[model samples]
Target: MTKINAFTYQPLTIPSHTESVSKQNQKPNAQKSSFSESLEEEYEKLPLKLSKHARERIDERDIHISQTEWNLIHSKMQEAKKMGINDSLVLTKDAALVVNMPNQTVITAMGLEEANTRIFSNINGTIVINH
Candidate 1:
């Protein structure tokens, strides 16, 4: 019987000249993989959480929020809280969001275009975010 050497195949990969400098040039933990992660972090820092009704309303209304918007809202909410405001009318260029600051959840949301010229009462405070 003829005996041959055991076969071991190695695939060729062209070597890359990338240096360790590439690693240094990159910022540590610079990228976030998901929006949920950052949102969770922000939620943790703030004692705020969305109500089921609020969440449903957002979905039903197809209201979307960016990270920047959320940050702005959080800041405004903090201000409202300090001023002893409970339900706050938050007016942004794109959205009219009602947030229950004490409850730490958004009550409902509407498009600015739709909410334009509409009156909102019973809110102890109103925050108009320009730009």
Candidate 2:
């Protein structure tokens, strides 16, 4: 039993409806980040090796890809995998790359100027990215 006015006032406790919704939202986001991170780690462990010919082309062409461009290329390749693509021609703002998807190898690379002038053939898929 309890007295209404004899002691200090008390209030009833309740939970907000948004509390559960917010928790559910956080869970999926956390899982997605963890899953992606693990996938990247596994990918990094396996070499995304560049062929000797590709290296020579990069050196001769003087094409430089920044870290951001590299990450974008990495992600685009993952997307290509889902689309049943093997050899891909990736056209980026700064550079063009020919990637062998299964082996995660870079077959060749060149600057945009070179790519624009030349025709890319024998590629199963083409990927375009901002940078």
Candidate 3:
């Protein structure tokens, strides 16, 4: 077998001024851009589909009240009591208030002022009302 030198097989280098031409013809980073870019064109169009009714119907749950509603209810209950309604009861979603009648027997038993304080002290929520 005849052996030829490896250097003899290589072609001579051609020094062409192709920098500008090469830069102009450079392809965009197709792989990198496709992964990172937010272009909506590349995605496949979704197929037409039927909308199914939700399996579980939403439960009609009781809604909670805000601080304002609590104050309003409290004021309304007090106003109703001030107008001479005896043993009145206010039933709210989250709270209830009962105003006991000013019985002469109970007044004699527990004293008027102390009983009044105990009756009016039935308040709810962290925020205390001025009235």
Candidate 4:
């Protein structure tokens, strides 16, 4: 296993090969490949993720959000985060999304019509996106 320095964020590689019976007491260490490291970096760079409940709500409501619209929402959410918004109600042309800014997660989603009659609590900001 590769250990990372908490302060430096650098990978500490351990010896992959172990010695014979003379060093039997020592624990074996597995080396992490560069590919795996790159994969982890890419995963960390993802902008947002949908919680299970949010995915269920979107599917149940038959909400259709295009990739372009999703990109816009992510960008706007990042801007909102910079402004000290923790939770936000994002209103798009057809959907309403309650997003947790710091975690970059969508907590819930619904159609605009359904959102209009509902009340959102615990939200510090609201983002209105036309697309």
User: Candidates' lDDT values, in order?
Assistant: 0.75, 0.82, 0.35, 0.83
Tens-digit lDDT string for candidate 1 (1-131): 33358766666665474566576556443554355567556545544576667666666777777767778888889988998999888888778888888777887778788788789877888889877
User: Which residues of candidate 1, in runs, are more than 4 Å off?
Assistant: 1-47
| Per-candidate total of colliding backbone pairs | 0, 0, 0, 0
Q: What lDDT does model 1 reach? A: 0.75
TM-score of each: 0.58, 0.61, 0.23, 0.64
Runs of candidate 4 exceeding 4 Å displacement: 1-46
For residues 3-72, what per-residue lDDT tens digits would candidate 4 score against the true structure? 5664545566667654554355442322335555674564355468888798779879998887678888
> Comparing 2 and 4 by lDDT, which wins?
4
How many times do residue backbones clash in model 3?
0
lDDT of 2 by residue, 15-131 (tens): 578788889989988999998788456435534667778877876887777666777787889889889999999988878899999988999999988788998888899999973
Candidate 4, TM-score vs. the true structure? 0.64
Better of 2 and 3 by TM-score: 2
Per-model RMSD to reference: 9.3, 15.2, 25.8, 15.4
Residue by residue across 31-83, what tens digits does model 3's lDDT show?
Answer: 55765444223212211111111101101122233446545644654555466
Screening candidate 4 with a backbone cut-off below 3 angstroms (N, C-alpha, C), the clashing residue pairs are none
What is the Cα-based lDDT of residue 129 in candidate 3?
Answer: 28
Error of 2 at 74 (Å): 1.0
Regarding TM-score, does 2 or 4 come out ahead?
4
Q: For model 2, what is the error of residue 84's alpha carbon versus the real structure, in angstroms, after optimal superposition?
A: 0.3
lDDT of 4 at 45: 54
